[model samples]
Target: MSNTSEAIDNDTVIKEFIDLFAQQDATTLAPYLDQDIVFENYGSPVVKGRENVVSLWAEVFSTMERVEFTTLNQAVNGDIVIAEQIHGLALPGRPFAPIKNMAVYRMRDGRIVEWRDYTNSEYARTLM
Candidate 1:
């Protein structure tokens, strides 16, 4: 659990954090991640540490021509926030596709300590 005394609005934090992905600027997004943050993408090996996670996102953002995340619903419990979202993505030459996704975020000291994303890998592969 995170420091409950911080009076953190975890829902807002998650919303803003996810919104940053649309900008595709990892540097701008880095501050929201804890130094020891852990990130796991669907069907992918877990990535540990903020730098590594940032690098991974940077690489992904490079390949993306456009990115948008629309949160269909959000639930917050203590230090965790769960979001159901449709991630619209467009590669350099490909058209945008709205991919259904569910993401779990763990917050500590106002930074995201852990994040796990669940998505339809088979459907996502069709866009790749």
Candidate 2:
């Protein structure tokens, strides 16, 4: 636990983290990450460390003209949170259909310690 005084419910932390992603602002997202955070995308290598994770988001954001995530459902169990969402993305010249995404988050001291995203590779490939 980094700061007990600032600790919030793990569910809230995960919800807010997902909300912040819609804004596509990595700087705003940084405070919600633990220093040693780990982020794993569906088909990519694991990203370790807060800075590395944030940088990855920044890169993704830069390539998108618009990004939105609509939560279909969310569930919480202790410090673990699971969110099911439809991710809407728009690139410069292509319209990205909403893609189903499932993310699991682990919280510690109001910050995200780990995040793993699962997506349909076949559906995702069609968007490219």
Candidate 3:
């Protein structure tokens, strides 16, 4: 890939990463996740393993009324990717929760191996 093409590919990966969270498509998501992957949300346990990650989302996606994301920026270098985003979740009759967060992903072999999410209390209510 040319320099610019590679950069675009990285950008696409970052965008797709957010899309995966919104879609909660575990089958499609598993291949891009590493075996020892670590995933976190504000209130959930630190999720590990590709299958575990898939399983967690599988269970969570079942109850979703709607999930949406608006990414603010992605900063990527080598195997590190950081994306800042605003997201909202609507759960049936409940009011939508607005969340502001930064997602940190460690990529290895072009797949996410470790991930962390950072946000403050009220700003993290969507993760509930």
Candidate 4:
């Protein structure tokens, strides 16, 4: 059992956090992450800490013209939520493209403590 004062709905929190990413609202996204969050995106180095993750997202948002994630499928098991998604991005001169990917999140007290993303590095590279 969790020692936290309130029980957290893992599914709801995961969905809301992803929705914030789809909206490119890093400011709103920050609160949903644990202070010592750990994130690993495919083809990228592992990022640790909530503030560092936010900074990374800030850099991404600044570089891209638009970005969004369309959830294709999702499942929740205990404190883990797995989501299959289509990542859409519109760069400065490129047309919007869809990148198939999946994200696994581990939640604690309604905040994400660990997040790991899986996707094709070749496809992701093309976006750059």
For each candidate in turn, the TM-score is 0.91, 0.88, 0.81, 0.88
Residue range 13-90, candidate 2, lDDT tens digits: 767777886798888889999999999887899999999999998998999887888888887776777899988888
Clashes of each: 0, 0, 0, 0
Ranking the candidates on lDDT from highest down gives: 1, 2, 4, 3
lDDT for model 3 comes to 0.76
Report the Cα RMSD per candidate: 2.6, 3.6, 2.8, 3.2
Model 4, range 18-121, lDDT digits (tens) per residue?
67766665777899999999999978899999999999998888777888887888888777889998888777888887888999998887889999999998
Name model 4 segments beyond 4 Å from true: 1-8
Worst 10 residues of 2 by lDDT: 1-10
Query: Where does candidate 2 stray beyond 4 Å?
Result: 1-8
lDDT of candidates 1 onward, in order: 0.88, 0.83, 0.76, 0.82
Candidate 4 lands at a TM-score of: 0.88
Look at candidate 2 and tell me the lDDT of residue 41: 86
**Model 3 stretches with alpha carbons more than 4 Å out:** 1-8, 126-128
Pairs that collide, model 2: none
Residue 91, model 2, lDDT: 83
Residue-wise lDDT of candidate 3 within 1-128, one digit each (tens)?
35455556666776886787677566878878889999887566888899998898787667667777778988876667788987766777777777788888887766888888887866465355
Model 1 ranges with Cα > 4 A deviation: 1-8
Query: What is the Cα-based TM-score of model 3?
Result: 0.81
